[model samples]
Target chain A: MNIYFFKISTLLYFLATMVYSVYLILLKDDLLRWASRTVLLGFVIHTLAFLSRYVEAGYTPVTNLHESLSFFAWMIIGVLLIAGLRYRIKMLGSFLTPIALILMLFALALPKEILPLAPVLRSFWHPFHVIFAFLGNAFFTLAFCCGVMYLIQEHQLKSKRMGAIGKRLPSLKVLDDLNYYSLKFGFPLLTLGIITGAVWAEYAWGRYWGWDPKETWSLITWFLYAALLHQRLTVGWRGRKAALMAILGFIAVLFTFLGVNLLLPGLHAYSNW
Target chain B: MKEKLNLGLKLNMEIIVIGLNHKTAPINIRERLAFQDSEIEEALRRIRSIPSIRETMILSTCNRVEIYATSKDIEKAVQELKQFLSEIHRFPLERFERNLYLLIGEEAVRHIFRVASSLDSMVVGEPQILGQIKEAYQRANESKASGVILHRLLHRAFHVAKRVRTETKISNHAVSVSSVAVELAQRIFGTLEDRVVFLVGAGEMIELAARHLVSGGVKKILVTNRTYERALTLAREFQGEAFPFGEMSVGLKKADIVISATNSPEPILTSEQMIRVMKERKHRPIFFIDIADPRDIEPEVGDLENVYLYNIDDLQKVALENLKDREKEAERAEGIVREEVERFVRWYQSLEVTPTIVALRKKFEEIRVRELEKMLSLHPELTEKERKSLEAMTSAIINKILHEPITHLKEKDEEAMADFYIDALQTLFQLPQSSEVAKEEEDARI
Candidate 1:
């Protein structure tokens, strides 16, 4: 039943993405309220489905590829709701919902059979490693969305084309600020996650740093964000460059979280697909 | 009383709007014609006393001053209102005649809807005109200068404005530079709702920017200027903290957004200062809006990561973009106004049958009650309960008898049919020709 609810929530999110897309296209203010509300409703049902999975698994739900993808989608939306309320950028959802919907769809398409919890994955440090990592990735995803919006809005302004999309998107300052905040929020959490993962690795595998593909990619993602933050601090590198870097950071996070688990053979690999 | 009520939706009734707007008149002329709130009641009273001007509403604003009145003769009402305008300001009619525009009947209604919808504003989609119109109507209503005609028209206009506001994209984005600055800050920080804004100058543009930030929900403000006294005064004005000019670096490090509009010969903030500030603040993103004429901040400051700097020219560019967006949305708003105008015209048509409906009901009640009383006198054996039931039965019968005709009369685009029903009801039932209804309404008003 919870899985069914999850599927339903994915469909709702897809529809919400469509609604926000239309709102962005038409610059319709009324559609924004409905779009946000639809996402909120989907988020609520998605939480129920996610929590139920935790109940069933007797652990954090993000154990495998399918669980990770779904959990990532869930966490991104959880952050989106909080950030959306904070930013009040209805147009941000237009860019964010599709990414979330795509993630949910990918998760739904993956294997549904519950994998038995591996003895290594059952360590207490596993939850900390997963939650902070997921949250960090979620913040990066927000940065990616805002970065995309910043580029679009900046292009619109520079190109002298104040079209519907340009008008709907928030200003560059707003996007950059949110982008910076996301990096700040996500980077530390990501560091904590990597540290926890190292501890968990040492406990289960007797090695703290194995140079596994997941660990390597996670380090790469961390470096990308570090560079982004460093450039931002030292040089005040904002606007398009910052936005692009934030987007790059998310791409790195995606590789670290999903690509490593799927294609690269490593100790961190939990699922074949 | 009969003359006052003559300006209904019935035949020969006309609504006339005589006004000077921003486009038609200079600011000097517009301001002269504008009515203060204290003067609105007296003006409405005086205008109502003008012959053929049965109802009057004066909408006075900085951008325009309009007089909306109703009469049986549009030309005479127009002349009276024009004369009133000329006489009140002691200006000759010919002097201001060239600056006034007049619309009669349906055109007047459409003009009102467009004005209420802000499509007719000097800056298209501005929000102040609707409130001004409402206040004008309120004054007219309090003075009893607005009877049924003005009441329906103004009420429908308010509704149309609301519809245009909600249903269209007329007032979605901020077009002003100060507002756009605030808007950009919001986009960057996610919200100014909890952010602290540092105002880095004491210029009019900077004051405007500070106001925008405060209104946008900035929780605290920091004011600094080259002159400490001015900074203290400006900070006191904003109810914010004032810091010494030398502490600007500290202020920059703490502030989320900095708006600089100071009169400086050269750039007040350079790239080096920003780098230090960014480092000190741990590289948190800070938004800088340099609205000063000579540009208070160095242009290269924007090149830094996490520093979003918008010079006045850049803000102007954004403002221009937003204005274009507003113009595009204004087209959509105009369509909404057109739709509302047509709807209101139909409603006005249906409204023509209302008096006859009222009279018809009154005639039926008179006959039913007379018969009921006569029957009770003839047969005193009728119980109070039975009498009450008979009253209910008669009222129900009358309602049922009138339902179909009333519904048919209220349908859209049936003005001629409404006239026909109105005349038939008046002639067949020998209903009083709305003069009695007018007197009754007037009596009720008293």
Candidate 2:
């Protein structure tokens, strides 16, 4: 049942991505509305899928590669829907929806069978750590999209070429503000996720500070965002510099989330696929 | 049958448009001929009071002055309207007569449509002409100077203008230098609200761009000029702060958008100076509009991380490009105007009493001829002369029977009543309905 719902939501997200792509080209308000509504519907069904998965597994669903990727995509869409309610940036979805769709597609390609939770994975801190970490990643994904848009728009303005794409993009101030907001929210969540992971590590392994590949990469990603946020608050770093940093920070996020597990043997790499 | 029907009676009342536009006249001549807003109602009344003119409306704008009227004699009405213009403005007839264009009937209708749709504007597809025309029409309506023909014609003109606006991209892009500046600024800042504008000189072009920004919702304006007094005066006008020319960099530091138009011989704001200012402003985006001939800002400032600089030539190029775009869309707008003109002409033709009368007579004549032919066949021995006499007698009888109602339909007085009579006669006699007329009648009812 959870698989069916997940497949349906992935299809809806695909449809929403296609609509947003056309909306970017046509620049029609009605198409944007339709795209946003489709995304909201997809997010709702995706939540249902997550809840069913949690029920079927009798635990949180971030236990393997498939469940984690799916949860990450779901978190991204959930953050996007909440952000949509707050901001009037119509073209943000045109950039962000495709990322979520790609993540869902990657999740769908992985194994779907539910398995019993391993004894070591069973802990109260595990779900809280995964949730906080994935939520942080989701907000960083938003910042990354805003950063890319800011670069395109800023380049167009700097070059004094008011092309079609430049006209559709939001202002530099708005994109920068969104980036800052994402950082403000994501940074705290990231700090919490790190703390919760440490607490869970003590219970699962025996030491609170293990320099496993995932743990080391997560620290590196944390330091990158920390430096960005520090500079933003101190020297008033914004516009191109800030946008570039946000984009760079998201790259570190991707590596910490996926790269550490795929290439390196880590204590967290229990996918066994 | 078509020719015979057309020859039954003449439709003497014709739509005549007489005017001079920017293309045909110099500004001096156009100004002399233009009707002031307060005097327009009087001018409309005076024109409508002419014996030949039945209904009239006058449209006078900065670019054109046009008189749209329905008249029995086009030549006489055109001559009188020209005379009226000379008398009202107290200008000599011979001076501006050559600039006048006289369009009659369908040509006049098409010209009015084109004008209302902004196709005939100096800057084609500018929206101000439509609003001007609507105001002119309202004055005509208020003064009771325009009757059925002008009323319907102006309504159709407004409709055509609306269609052109929606169905074409003619008015989408800004075509003037000042407007294009604002457009680029909006593209940069999204909304101009709470954004500060710095004006760095005192000139007409600078003032125009500043006014556009003010209307665009810029939060504050900072004025700096070579003469501190001039800066203070301009600043007072915009309700903004005034800074001496020496403090321009100070104003630049706070400004999100700067428009500089000074008569300086060399670049005033160099890249090195702007680079310093960029840091002071923390590299926030700043738009520089250099309207001066010798550029006020250095060309290299545009290369700065977040500074957008556009000189006079660059702004003109964008405006010219937008003009070219409007021209491309103007073709589609012209097609819309052409289609609407045809529809309006059909409705106008339906207003003519001659066509319906001719149709009614032809219907009677057809029946008369059919019955006469059957009788002649029965009386095979009848002579050719007798058949000719019989045909003449039947035609005479038909004319006698149709004379009263035809005359009533042809009545020039009370045009609204005439329209009613024409519709009723067409429906009562089951005459062939012009589809356009039917649609118009349905629209009228609605």
Candidate 3:
């Protein structure tokens, strides 16, 4: 039943991705609303599936490869839904929906089997760390989307080719501010996530910092974002530079989350599923 | 029969329009012929009194003063309209005769559709022409000058205008310098709602540009002129501050966008001066619009990292680009207007057809009734039930025989072919011109 929910959720994400792709080609009001609704429905089914897995496995369900990818996909949708409600930027869905769908599809390709929890995974700090990391990554994902929109809009403004395709993008200033906002909220959550992981590292491995592959990459990702935020806040660096930094920040985050766990060998990479 | 057919041909309704527009005449002549709002009702009243005119409407916009009317005598109607224009405006008829262009029938209908859709405007795809035509239609309707033909035609014009607007991108881009500035501001800032704009000089062009920016929702406005009192008055009108000309750099630092239209011979702000202001403002983006003929800002200022300076010629280039875009879109708008004209003409030609078919059937029924009465009197010995069946059989035969001809008359593709068919029917069956004859009767009674 839980797998059925996950399959349905993944199917909805696929359909929404198709609609959003069509919307990118030709912007329409109905297509956008339908895509958002599809994302929301997929989000609900995904939440239900996670809860069912938690009830059966007696854990938060982020301990496996499939769970981690699925959780990342869910967080992307959760953050998008909130941003979509607040910003109401119609074209944002046209960019982000495909990303969410591909993430979920890759998750579904992995084994769906829920294994017994490891003894070391049993700790209070573990859930907080994973939760905050997912939230931070989710916002960074949105900031990445805004950064792409900002560059496109800025190019349109500078080029003076005020035509149909140029009209589809949001204003450069709006996209820049949204990029700043996501970074502002996501940075603190990332800090809390890193702090929680450090506190939990002491409980599980008898160390405050392990210099593990995931840990080292996460610190690099954190520093990348710190530079981005600091340049934006202090130097008032904006437009092309701010947008490029957001894009780079998200790349580092992607490496920290997926590349470190799946490829590099480390203590934290043991639960590769 | 030939004489009666000639009478029916003379009674046929015709639509005609005679006017001089921007294309046909200079602005001086167009303004001279233009009608004031107060004079429209009186003009309509006098024009309707002309012997040949049946329905009349006048569209007197700045670009054109067109009189649209339907009548039986197209030549006489045109002559009457010409005389009416000359008499009312007291302008010599010979002076404007070369400028006036005349269209009749389907050509006139197409002209109206083009006008209503703004394709006939000086600036093609402008929206104001449609509104002006609507107001003219409303005035005609209220004055009871427009009748059946005009009511249908003007309503079709409005519908065509709506289709052109929704289906075409003709009005999508700004074509003027001031509007281009507003558009550029929107492209840069995403919105002008909370941005500050500073006016460097009080030239008329700058005021026009400032008006466009203010309406676009610029948060604050600062007016600076060499004459401080003039600046104060203009600022009071805009509900903004009148800053000192000595503190232009201070004003520039506070501004997000600046419009300069000064007549100054020397460059007001060079690239070096702007770089200093950029430092003071932490390198926030600034836009400069130099709309004066003698440019206000140094051209080198545009090379600054976050400063976008557009001179008058550059703005004109952008406006030209936008105009080209609109011209491309106008192809689609023209297609819409053509489609609408075809549909309206089809419906209008169909209007005359149904009446002709009905009148032909009426003529046939009259003959059948007369013959039936004569036969019934001759067969006085027959039973009532037999008489009823006989009458029904004759009626069915008449309906069957007349159906093909009626269908043939109603199915004509071209107006000329329809007229030929209508003329044939009137000659073969002598279908009386009921409406025209009734109008004559009313004329006699009055």
How many residue pairs clash in each candidate at the backbone level? Answer: 15, 0, 0
User: Mind sharing the TM-score for model 1?
Assistant: 0.72
Show where candidate 3 strays beyond 4 Å.
A1-61, A122-125, A206-208, B1-11, B38-42, B90-92, B224-239, B242-246, B261-273, B292-300, B354-446
TM-score of chain B for predicted candidate 1: 0.71
Predictions in order: lDDT: 0.81, 0.85, 0.83
Worst 10 residues of 3 chain B by lDDT: B1-10
Interface RMSD of 2: 1.7
Better of 1 and 2 by TM-score: 2
**Tens-place lDDT digits, model 1, residues B158-192:** 87788788777778677888877777775566557
Model 3 clash number: 0
Question: What lDDT tens digits, residue by residue, belong to model 3 across residues B129-225?
Answer: 9889989999999999997678778877877788788777777788998888888887677789889889998878878888899889886889899
Candidate 3 has an fnat equal to 0.45
DockQ for candidate 3? 0.41
Clash count, predicted structure 1: 15
Give the RMSD in angstroms, all C-alphas superposed, for model 2. Answer: 7.4
Candidate number that wins on lDDT, 2 or 3: 2
Model 1 over residues A59-128: C-alpha lDDT tens digits? 7777787887888888899898999999887677887788899999998898866767988888999989
